[model samples]
Target: MQKGSLENHLFRKGQEPLGWELRLKIAIGAARGLAFLHTSEKVIYRDFKASNILLDPVYNAKLSDFGLAKVGPINGNSHVTTRVIGTYGYAAPEYVATVP
Candidate 1:
């Protein structure tokens, strides 16, 4: 079944705002999905934000929009250099700084 992004639920007008319990659960679920990506596959989700998280009818959260996801650094390198691209203010501050 088709589902909408978390942003849709949060920003839709005339609808009751999501309760704190659901919000907390969504946050925890999103974090778990992200943690799996990082620990299981070493993926860096560069575009992690509300818009990229979709919720099912029961409000189960899942990460989407993998276009910006990157394989993390290998061989013990400190970091990987790449073009800065992500929703403004959503990406971490250090990620937005252009590296020479």
Candidate 2:
């Protein structure tokens, strides 16, 4: 990742703000990556955040760090019940409140 993490580009001190077009491009790329994992691979990426999205020199986004990934529900099960885990601030409020 020549550009390093998206977080660094977006939030790190002294980094320039991303242009609107670049932001949209990066966002779409990241979404596509997550969509592939969820739909094609049947995997849940539990840690999805700016820091987990790496960018190439052209600002193409790629997902990194799958340490928290898990196999999605199978065998006709609609969901999997597991303790909530991931970065503290990144989880959806509804998910955090209802998962337990």
Candidate 3:
């Protein structure tokens, strides 16, 4: 529980920056986690951001804070309609247009 968000590690002074390989690994892990949510779990992560990604001591990444997540549209539907809720500048253009 003491592990901090990726943002902390990235921006904190006096901390060594994440190496290229470790950064790549974290990116891949985050992608795989998001992919699993979108495909296997039918969930859309509306709040993907550095602050929402938690890292362990070894730098393994895991997504956290699903308060803004929503269930994906049912099969055969092009998109689901819902009021948009997430950090500003992070929402997709389509999502911004779709939200009232």
Candidate 4:
């Protein structure tokens, strides 16, 4: 995390924009991280945002802050019902409506 959060590199004033290649790499890395959490770990990442995505010196994206994470549905359950929690404007529309 030498580069800190991706949000800092993205929205801080006077910083150059990340190029398309780097952006794509970050996106892919983030997606892979999420996928691993969902599939292998069976965890629901309730707080996924730019501020939670840390970057290394080489710009590899890594997820951080699992405080809001929850164990996913198990057995025959289709979903887990829980109180909605996450940063404002970051929740999906379906998630906000259904809390699934």
RMSD after CA superposition, every candidate: 2.5, 1.9, 2.7, 2.6
Alpha carbon lDDT at 90, candidate 2: 96
Model 1 C-alpha RMSD vs. true structure (Å) is: 2.5
Q: Which stretches of candidate 2 lie over 4 Å from their true place?
A: 76-79, 97-100
Higher-ranked by TM-score: 1 or 4: 4
Per-residue alpha-carbon lDDT of model 1 for 1-100, expressed as tens digits?
Answer: 1558888778889867889999998999999999999989999887888888898878889999999888877898755666777888886788677645
Per residue, candidate 4 scores C-alpha lDDT tens digits across 1-100 of: 8998999989999988999999999999999999999999999898999999999999999999999998888897766666788986888877688654
Worst 10 residues of 3 by lDDT: 75-84
Alpha-carbon lDDT of model 3:
0.86
Instruction: Count clashing pairs, candidate 1.
Output: 0
Q: Any runs in candidate 4 off by more than 4 Å, and if so which? A: 75-79, 93-100
Model 2: which residue pairs collide?
A: none
Give the Å error, residue 50, model 3.
0.3
Q: 69 in model 3: Cα distance from truth in Å?
A: 0.5
TM-score of each: 0.81, 0.87, 0.80, 0.86
- Residue 4: error of model 4 in Å? 0.9
Model 1: lDDT of residue 14: 83
Q: On residues 1-100, what C-alpha lDDT tens digit does candidate 3 reach at each position?
A: 3568888879989988888999999899899999999999999988999999998878889999999888887878755655678887877888778766
